[model samples]
Target: MNLPDTFHLIGGDALKTGTGGSLEHVNPATGESSTLELAGADEVDAAVAAAREAFGVWSGLAPMARRYLLQQLARRINESAADLSALSTYESGMPVVYAAQMAAVGPAEWFDYYAGWADKLNGEVIGAWDFNYTVPEPYGVVAAIVPFNGPVWEIGMKAAPALAAGNTVVIKPPELAPYSSILFGRLCLEAGIPPGVVNVVLSGPDGTGALVSHPDVDKISFTGSAGTARKILAAAAANLTPVVLELGGKSGVLICDDADVDSAVGAVAQFAIAQNAGQICTSPNRVLAQLGVYDEVVEKLAAVAGGFVVGDPLSESTQVGPVISVASADRIVGMVGEGVSAGTARVVTGGSRLDGPGAFVAPTVLADVATDSRLAGEEIFGPVATVSRVADDDEAVAVANGVDAGLAAYVFSRDISRCHTLAKRLRSGSVSINGLGNHMIYSPFGGKGASGYGREGGRAGIEEFLSVKSVSAQL
Candidate 1:
């Protein structure tokens, strides 16, 4: 694949000095070195400083000017969609087609979606005795920590709004997949964004603590595990910085007896295990099926899991790629093994690697998995799904809400009333009624409870990057 043009810390044409630490970008699909770049505390500081300086001008610009630039950026992203897709596939180790469709095209979708909202991001005229309105303003510098999985989507989601709302950004990319994130910065320059408006930095395996804890960072937007979110919150607290965390989920799917088994099974499998190898925070980890159709559902799902081709992500025919890494694969297998040891479920398709090299795992399915099993209770961020039988729709809802995570849920049923009923009782931020409906850019996307606070996407997304300022002008 053709590599990115060049990676640099560009702030008004200045390349900041670094501490000389470097990160080796590896193509997980081919197990080859892709890019090597600087990563250290010093580098992090420089990026933050760049954003700090740019915030003055960028944040001071009129909302119209900011919106104009964002619109232009969206157009540039559409122009570079092909190249971004290739780079995303090389770095993310996902199927080329899915990578293009999701990481590349999905980001473009976000830019275009958020761009339209730029002019519409309005502050409300509040109820007051006097003439008063709450004007929303951008924070100074936003510190966005993006996960490697779906990096482009989150980056665009975070950066677009942060920029549209007149905030400069210093993004701390997951070290494992910094290549595409860095290239995205170059695209920003090509899109006519002034230098220092957006800066990209790589953090070590320990995580981007330096960036999160930095004093200059006005706000923190993170997407990762709940365990990591805690640390980020604590770190940001020291600086008294505001934060927006979109954390993990052990999400569930409730399949009612009245549901179409084939359609339900297909929908759950596609979103749960197939998408990004189940790396998504909203991926359904547990499938709570009504006993009436449980057996048929399990059988159909097993067939679907068994048929998925797992190997190199770059292969056009490969439906599922390896887990993030060997360690990640091992963690997922171990979770399944725990279920097996507990005698709660049977590993129907895969529980281990299927290939000779790289971190490949068979598309694993666990049937008759007990509702209380670790595999069913925790967020297994891999292609391992637990299927459990529920006594009724009530029992299904209980099982689905048993976990602390309330991110996203899926309910499949033919009866409209049953669908609406289950959807209401299912404790999640968003629910897919019959199938996984396409998420509209105008809708709110986030979770409640342990899944993390705050919302992203649509009007809520842009507002997350903004702060309210009440103004009363004397006439």
Candidate 2:
């Protein structure tokens, strides 16, 4: 993978010294590490200023022109999928197979999806009274803070909509996995997105704080932990800037008695548990199975989970790979081991680290986990899941809603009415019936309660970067 020693964003060249510290990035698949220069307050100010300067010009453009440029970026993203996928595996420990679909090619879909929205936006005229209309205007400068788990995907999620709405952006990438995002900045310029329309600042929390707190920044959209969101909220409060946040989740996977057994197990064990080392917010790790299917689901899920071998992420045949870092692996292992030792849960399959290099945590499925325990309630951003038995659909909904998070829930059942009923009762942002028609390219993805607020897909997402101006004239 081609890596840059210093991060220089397009309009605002950001190769500068930050409040000094180690900017070393470690490859989770190996122990090797490299360093990049951090952006300080100066870089933040420059990037913000550039974004502010460019916003008027970008917003003033004919909508079709913006659409054409966004589509060009989409084409570039598709062309560069392979290199970006490798970066995801190297930097975030995302397995290469899934990285291609998610961290790489997936962004192309986002750009295309939002690109179409650029020219389609329309204002409403209130014909009941005087000729009054509401015009949707883009917020000036949007600050997009993306997480390490899925850099390109979230970058596309945040930036595409902002740009579609005619807003300029300054992005702050996670310190651990900044490679793909840094490359993305160059892609913008190559795709004919004018300089200052998209800028990236490389820094830790200090530099991020500088960008979030900047007076000129009009909007902030972040995807990370709730704790970090609190700090960002505090900073944005000083400027009273509106923010769109997508935070952590301990999403539930509900398998009803009448559901297709193999399909449910496969979605949970094969996709949700194994993908990205379960680093995504919608991991669907807190599994609640109805009593009739609980034992069978547990047995089948164990076999499927155990079948995956933890190894190098670069290997094509490897099903499971290392997590983002050794620290995360250790935490996930401890969460399971401690729960099992405390008699709160029982391990159904692999639960310990492999005796090899890399930050490998074997795929784990813990059965009979206490609903109130950490393994069930907390967000374990690793390849670990906790299963519990529910007496009925009501109990399943209750147990699923018991957690503080409400990002997503997976419900499996042949009975459509029962599925809708449970989906209604379950407190989640989006409910997937039989694992379809939800959280997709056009779905509005977000969470409620502790999962944070604001949607990140489709038209709702683009509206996040826009403000409404009511225009009326006396006739």
Candidate 3:
């Protein structure tokens, strides 16, 4: 059994076929059979072996060759954007346009942007006692471990930079969203990437662990939960291998007293819980609103959230689609329960699943939430937002900084001084003023502390996949 358009266990197809164990994909939206495949530890090993072998050649390829292939891959991704978008929406239970915005065109944009950097990857010349320079080098075989939510974009964020830097890869896509990433391999092949340079394996947590800890995997770039990130770090440490972890976020959103309450509520709600069903690591889960404007913000946000359409992802009008699975759906709702039990807030719109074959949850708004409330402190990857009232800007900054995870934070204020002041006070990696856009493909983005380490975008992203080597010689 195999998923549609998927060449599972790519590099070691023969060995993968021999593996007795099989994995299956259950489309949350349909509650029926979707895609299935055979994969196991042996198949994982074979994929790594293929990548390890490919690394020797790929890492040695001329920068021009690598640049050409990356550009080709970008073009191919653009050409096949529609199908990829449709598949992501179908499999992940997200709105088609949302999936397209993040997965298909987003990746194409990433690849094309990174393609330009591929040729420009430079070594720096520094003055020593004699002439000397530092050369940037690529790690051999990078194991890219992607999570279930927004899998394609995250994987592309990792693979494009690693490939552009001339590093071969063994990609382990989450079993929940395997098809699109597998389809991504086809795009790579169509773009003329070497056969073994990019290999894909589909499996569960165990399969992912084995792939990450494999001796041949020189570097691991993982995007998942904080708990999972710790384990991946441990696995990489066994071989003393390098790793980049982009993990969970319990980020904060601060709305100033003098700002536009309606705009802030709309932007914070949409950025916090609406996009990709609130699955992004950089999304804002805890909201800090100035006391003077808290009530108005909640009232406005609740009304706007009521207007969001939560239904079939295929529908053009759907605003919020199904959560990843029933289990995930339950977890999301459970957070709201804990919030209620803890006496932190009141549920405004929804706190339960929708009536459907799919695992859907309505847009949830929790008001009068305490700073330490379960909803405010925890990372709920669903359509839920927790609003915490702070006495002043100082208190707002305090509440924003009071989290173990600081991936991204949002701030709003008419005064640039106060905005910049609060932005500096927040401990997050990326701080947005006036509730603007997220970290683009051309800018550095990542988190600190439990949100995990390492940036994955722009020049910083490309640098994460590289190492510096000093060279000095007298002619």
How many residue pairs clash (N, CA or C atoms closer than 3 angstroms) in each of the candidate models, in the order given? Answer: 0, 0, 0
Name the runs in model 2 displaced over 4 angstroms: 10-21
Model 1, 1-475: lDDT tens per residue?
A: 6775445554754343245456667666666775455556777777889898888888887767777787787777777777777877777687775887666677877777776766676778867777799888888899888998878788887888888888899877776676677777877888888899998766564437788888999999989888888988888889899888788787788888888888888877887788788888887658888888888888999899888877777778888887677778778877778778889889888888766766777888889898887778888888887899999988888888898889889888889888888889988889888887644366888888898888888888889888999998665
> What's each prediction's TM-score?
0.95, 0.98, 0.96
Model 3 agreement with the true structure over 1-475: per-residue lDDT tens digits: 2346443645534222425256656777777555456556777787888887888788788888888888899889888877788778877887875878777888888888888888898998987787799999988889898888877788779999999888888888787877788888877878888878888887666677787788888788988887887788887788998888877788788888898887788786786667777777777657788878888888888888778887778888887888888899999888788778878789877888888698888888889898876677878888888888898988888888787888888888889898898888889889988875568687888888877788989899999889899998775
RMSD to truth, every model: 2.0, 1.3, 2.0
| Runs in model 1 lying further than 4 Å from the true structure | 5-8, 13-17, 205-207, 473-475
Error of 3 at 86 (Å): 1.7
Local distance difference test, per candidate?
Answer: 0.79, 0.87, 0.80
Return the lDDT, model 1, position 190.
82
What's model 1's overall lDDT?
0.79
Off by over 4 Å in 3: 1-9, 12-20
